[model samples]
Target: MLQFRLIVPADLTDEVAELITSTVGATHLTLLKGAALDPVGDLMTCDVAREAADPLLAGLRGLGLEERGLIAVDSVDMSLSRRSDDAERDAPGDGADAVLWDSMAELTEDESTLTVTYLAFLSVATMLAAYGVMLDSSILIVGAMAVGPEFGPLAGICTGLVIRRKQLVARSAKALVVGFLAAMLVTGAFAALLDLFGLFSRSQFERPHPATQFIWQPTADSFVVALLAGIAGVLSLTSAKSGALVGVAISVTTVPAAANAALALSYTAWHEVLGSAWQLALNLAGIVVAGLVTLLVQKWVWHRQRGRAAATSPPAP
Candidate 1:
């Protein structure tokens, strides 16, 4: 569950309260008449389940409460919530299910933007992937994927698409495209240097490297892997179970494909280079489709709960 602190104009108090109360996902709502600074306003504090947040928030916008006051939603650490015998028997683990619900509801592009650690990791990972693909080293490719930070923004892009957040979509796409391009260029330059010294060549790159061969052929299987990985990736984001993301790290060929393309360009093997480029596009598309669908389902479930709330609650007096 999440806690909301709502401040609204006095004139809209009745409608705002009615809106909050009418929200099926909200519970433990407490209303206040006035605070010193908000004498011309009203205040409301409430706890709401995740599945209920979307529609309730939408209703607030519909009621114009969105513009009337400060509406801030904060997380509740259920691990810190005091347990009681009053804990409902059906509640998901001391209301952690509610916590999970709210967190997912809170998922936004602004929320998913890369942080310092995120930037650092992604930079190193992309570099690693670029070099690995250039060398046609599968082991290095795998290692690069482990380091590449592309997944976060990729996930963000899909999140933006589902939520229709243009800012998020732009942010995510810029990060993905720019980040990969920069990494590839650097890695490609390095590969060119390696080839100039006869360390590797276009012929060498086209030669078999079992570990890096995945990029040579883009199959239906590759799309399936990316699609499944994308679904898992979003699940991790919504459930706040990021630990599961490590496995997702290895499941897609984005970094390797990127490295392959960069190295291919460096070696001037147009065919192998073009193939890897297609591989990158395929994987990115698969993830986006899967991610959009997953978020859509979550949105639908949240919307249905609000519909039920509207059915049960009467309008204000």
Candidate 2:
């Protein structure tokens, strides 16, 4: 459930109260008349089930409350009221399936920004993978995969595409591109440093590393894995099953492939560089495509659910 706090204009107090009362999954409305000093209106609060939040928020926005007043939403971890339970039961769909689009947009916007912390995480992950690749250590590779922050911008790009936000797409794309490029370059320089310390050698990298071969070998299965990961990633963000994101993080070889590409570049291994780059591109494309499709389907399903609810609802006299 979500809790909403609104400062409503004096004239719209009745309309706001009526809207909340009529909403199927909203309950516990509290109105304080003329309580907002700055806005000089009423202070109203209500609880709404997640499934009904989008439409309720849309209704409020349509009333010009956003421009004239203030709207704030927070998650409710626990609600002891029986009406809250009834509200959840009466809502059209499951709370876990609901997509709080406004919240998501804000989330992705923050995550997709190109920040120092983002770069630091990506670079560290890439360097770790560089060591893993040279040493042919699966443990280090997996650790690097978990540490990589590339998924944030990838998800941002997918969300932006589904919501038709061009600026979001641009920002996310820039973050993805610059983050990877910068990380790979840093990894390449780090690999050269390892060579200087006699810790890395061309022959060591050329040795058959059976466990880590998938990082450089682009097969159809690579794209398939990426597609599945993308679906899980988006589901994690939109739904309540966020823990699945760890599995999604480790399942893709994006960081490993980037590390391999950087290592191969340091050694002037054209074939390895090309193969790893192909693997990286294939995984990224698959994740983006799958995420886009998943979000579109979710949006469609929720729209239909709302339509069905509206059709069955009795007219308000």
Candidate 3:
């Protein structure tokens, strides 16, 4: 369950309470007046189930009591009454099962804006990618893939499109494109500078490293890997199974392929560069398409379940 702290004038509190009380899924309701000294409204606390959060939030939006005897929904947090139950269920080694549609809905919590944390992670991943190529290290490439930040926005985009939220879709797509372009360009320049100094010989790009061969070759297996990984990635994000996310990242080859393209270009291996670039595009498109479709399917299933649950269960008291 989620808790809400709303502050409103004593006079307006009754009407506001009535509005929220009438809102479906509001399991508990209470009102307090002048309990808050803030210039804003007074404080009231209430709880609602997770499935009811969205509609409740929608109902609360209009209560912004900035003027007159105002009402404000100041904050919300999960209630601990059931914390032990959920925490035990989500313990490590147990796959975190989450509702995929609800998971997607959660991404809009902050309205899909890019955060500084994502930029820092992307920077580190880009550097690791360049270093991996320089040292001919598969492990580093995998690490970079696992650490890459683009997936959040990619997931956001898929989620937004499924929910028909254009603002979220636009923001997420911008983040994804800008992050990719910035990382690739920076890594490319670094790789070129390293090549010029003979820090890593250009010969490494040509000598067949079995690890990178996949970047230059496209096959049905590539699509299958991307499709399955995309599905797993979404599921892991929504559920408690985030540990599996690192493996999903490495499996997709997005960051690795981008790094390979930049490294190959630095060495002026035009053919290899083209192949790597194509591979990057193919992998990203595969992930996006598969993610969008998965979310859509999940949303449909969730609605059916919700309908069934509503039909079978009585309304909340």
User: Where is model 2 more than 4 Å wrong at Cα?
Assistant: 9-12, 33-41
TM-scores for the candidates:
0.75, 0.94, 0.78
Clashing pairs in 1: 1-98, 1-99, 50-101, 50-102, 125-147, 138-211
RMSD per candidate (Å) reads: 4.8, 1.8, 5.4
Once fitted onto the true fold, the runs of candidate 1 whose alpha carbons sit more than 4 angstroms away are 31-43, 79-108, 111-123, 134-139, 192-207, 301-317
lDDT at position 255, candidate 3: 79
lDDT (10s digit) by residue, model 1, range 38-78: 43577788776655554567677677766667778886767
* Residue lDDT tens for model 3, 125-224: 8778767765668888889988886777778888888778787788887777777777778887777777788776777667767765776576777778
lDDT of 3 at 69: 43
Tens digit of lDDT per residue, candidate 2, span 1-317?
89999999999989988999989999999999888998788999999999999889989989999999998999899999999999999888778889988777778888899999999999999999999988889999999999998888998999999888999999999999999999999999999888999999999999999989889999999999999999999999998677888899899989999999999999998999999999999999999999999999999998888788778877768
lDDT of 1: 0.70
